[model samples]
Target chain A: MSQLHLTDEILMAFADGELEEPTAAAVAKAMAEDPTVAKRIMDFQQSRRLTRSAFSMALMPDVPPELQAAVLAQVASYEADGDSKAGSDIKPPQDAWIRRKRPFMQMALAASLAAIALALGYFVGWQAEPGTGGLIAQLESPLVHHELNSSASGKDVELPFGRMRVISTYRLANGSLCREFQLRSSTEAAEAVACRNSHWNATFALASPISDAGYTPSGGGDPMAAYLQSIGAGQPLVDEAEAKALAEAGR
Target chain B: MPAGIGQELVALLPRLRRFALVLCRSQPLADDLVQGACERALANAGSWTPGTKFDAWMFRILRNYWIDHLRRMRTEGMMEDISMQTQLVGDAGEGPILSRLVLSEVQRAIDSLPQEQREVLVLVCAEDLSYREAAEILDVPIGTVMSRLARARRRLMEMTAAA
Candidate 1:
């Protein structure tokens, strides 16, 4: 007999409980008889079990029941506020970090231009291949002193020219790692932190601008804000060594 | 629209929440993401057209958001790994809760899958979406979904089997 090759859609239909009773029964019977088919079913079941387990916890976050009510209430309020005004356009604080990030990028761009120019001058003697400069740049990055340690705090900071701060210290479900941080006072201003793992992730919180200065961190009662204040100017946020330390620290 | 639609949207939360968690495989982040999705859905409530499955629409939004999140993640220097099969079973869970062990292994195993395959698994197994519906949400042909899913299932089989 030609071997029966089960398609994923069939397995999926079976997995999702989408198969009609008779068909499902047949699949069950077949799975029981064929070890390979049985294994496939188990794998699908395992995948399902995993997804359910992970997401199930996320759903019931013990978000203070009152907080849940509050979030919903806030939603209602936002809908009501939609027509009354321009709507809360508070451009999340991370936008400030994003804005602050602009200058260094321009610097990096300028550096690239300079590097290219130097490369061209040095290679002028030969009709080199088109891809030469890239290879040179790659080799040269290691020669420079600016190093990023993937093993540091599992956290690293990136500021255009100014300073930033750490946000949360938590290991991600994935082994990659994560850290949260914010930018302190700046006129083009705001708050928020960026997270990253040893791999160089920089995830910024949703855009939330800095709240008014009058509201003390104690008054605001937001952990994110109080933490930013506690860090002081948030300057010298993190260096390469510290970054590596955070990475290795596993958070 | 009347409040009925709003209530309907709220009703879908449990299922949607389940889908979000499965995709991200992290409870805390999953909750955050679901909250973000809810906020976005409500904020753009006016844009929802009648006669469409809100779940489907929300799934699309969630899928797009996830893609964006992944793109943003790429800039952070994510590494790719291809581990040996023998070690797969060696890492199986050892915890108080039997379910937790199974669950954690499942989560890690799912994570090992390529992005394409993982989405298929999420759609078919986690979200209970039909192949055709998954096709629409993923913006791909039904066959493509099937192909990716087949490949994903194969990979999962490889990763989960005892060495």
Candidate 2:
């Protein structure tokens, strides 16, 4: 038989185990004969693996109790009706519940964004003080510098305002050592990013409420979140890698 | 209708939500979609075949529901919300920002694909559905499924390589 001309679709199907047996045998023969064919098959397999792995953590939120209750309520309603078909035309609780919930969600989102803006404006007043060139000279305080360089992710250090905690440390794609920190005063809290060069400097800041247990993005349009994305920050460092990154920063 | 479907749906909740997230790209919307799909599934329980693939059947219903939702949104002039909400990718106080960064990067890449390719990619690669099963769910020919899968993988590979 003439050498089987394998298109990408055939190779993909062969990798996916979707090809017929004889065709699969032919592809196997092609793979064995041609190194390139094997690599193509491997590429297809790798793509499948990458997709599977990416979705392994596919931003799944915990199932809300209301949703569970709604589902069970639906089932219960179905069962309660002697004829399930009678319930078939009824509107789902989720339909009404979500309709009622949407406006509230949008309002909450708008309120949070406004609060973040107000906070950013308040925080910007500090930058206007005479000689500081738009960046907060936070590291000029040796104690703050020491804490930022050596503090573990969850450690709390007392700041003059209230309290400061390093949320995470990671390297930007350009190999800059950056730390995400939350500064909580008695009344207000904000998450800020600082990266070190000759010294540490605050890069971006967002006003976040002190009420939340963990830092959350102030909705999608916030600047600090965009900064994180633009800088290509990878996953926060694990303990060992964090130490190594800190050490490399000459701590 | 089946004896264990309630429990099965409970078990499948996370995966269904994940699939909805991949399609809808918004947490609140995905939750609503999954709940609605579950409600529909229960209300139409008698139509489900007893011994067939339960998850695939659920997936088909969810996918059909999503298409209908898109149509409804278009009719209501609400199509802008989908694009605006696409940027909202985190699990809302669930995971650390650390992992969310990496995951969101992967999500951005996946999000860049055309919707047709995205649906096929997620169905086959993430859900682990067979091509034939996906074809049946998508109401497309098997060849069309393979072609879409091929294009999606190739685009993803090129993206990974460039990144």
Candidate 3:
């Protein structure tokens, strides 16, 4: 191959291992014949390394618990809905005897009844049945309303259905107060961003449930994160600032 | 929901998150993308052929979702401020000044590339996808992938050298 024929694209392809064997062999010959060619190839390799190292932290951070739970929950729900090939083979973990004997099961039953009651009471204005309030109502329960009204940013409230935590409070460019909160229940979790007008309008909401495993409360897995980025939510209000905002808004 | 699919999906989370980070360039947004992709993957699990490459399918879904998101943001006039917040500079006492400056400059150079070039570069160089695989994921021609990757590298080299 002529010295001038070793183009930058060819060298990059050779460095990236995208070239065919014969072409690679020809490139190797060109590099051997020319130190500048070899150095350019080396620079490409080093740049790739630097690019990888620059974002290496992405791989290092732990997968947020909410995300893990979301995946597991979806899988479990799929399986439990009798869609899996192994659904018939696998038995429920609790047998009749265990369920009849365990006091924990009784407590669970009671808690479930209480949850049903709370859902009914909270959605009474919109719907009589539990879980029938549609997506907006499912997110805007009495507890969530109270939490949004009473809790300052960065505070958590333990409600009957789940734990609600106010992540951040900010004002939109239109001068309306917006709050991002996370609601985590035993079976599912949701993150929502609501902007206050006459009432809180859910600008965005996403839910990911836990699988058979019980609930665990953690932070930072929000499906609306990208939307929030688009909207340019600069920084969350700190404690004092959140308090001041809430007070000034007469909340 | 297939017998072993759950475990496989779980195993792929870390890599998926990394790829999402490469696409979105923000940790929280990356996680959001992963979760959204997982939801769609679960809902459409039956459509996935049994013997197909699952990772490629998932990556395609994520890329499509991101594209749709970008389109929506653009329509709403919300695209200009979507830059990822990276803390490139640390406290003066934290690290050597020369090394920190180099790192910051390298990051800025990478960030300055156009989104198309950045995506291809991340897929090919960072995620170790072959040119063809990156093309498949990005739904672009193989030659397009190669050209974009080359342009990204050339731009990075020029910017960093100038810095």
Per-candidate TM equals: 0.41, 0.58, 0.52
Candidate 1 structure quality by residue, lDDT tens digits, B17-117: 55665466554445566666766666666555555456767776676666666676678766222222322222223123323333343456666786677
Worst 10 contiguous positions by lDDT, candidate 2 chain A? A92-101
Model 3 misses residue A191 by how many Å? Answer: 50
Each candidate's interface RMSD: 14.7, 10.9, 16.1
Best by TM-score: 2
Local accuracy of candidate 2 as per-residue lDDT tens digits, A14-118: 776667768878987776565566656655765665676566643445677887788778766766764545334322222111111132332332233223333
Which residue pairs overlap in candidate 2's backbone?
none
Which parts of model 2 have CA positions greater than 4 angstroms off? A57-59, A86-251, B94-98, B101-105
lDDT by residue for model 3 over A113-138, one digit each (tens)? 22223333321110112353233345
Top DockQ: which candidate number? Answer: 2
lDDT tens readout by residue for model 1, A118-172:
3332111011122333322322232111223232333334544323444344433
Clashes of each: 24, 0, 0
Query: What TM value does model 3 have?
Result: 0.52
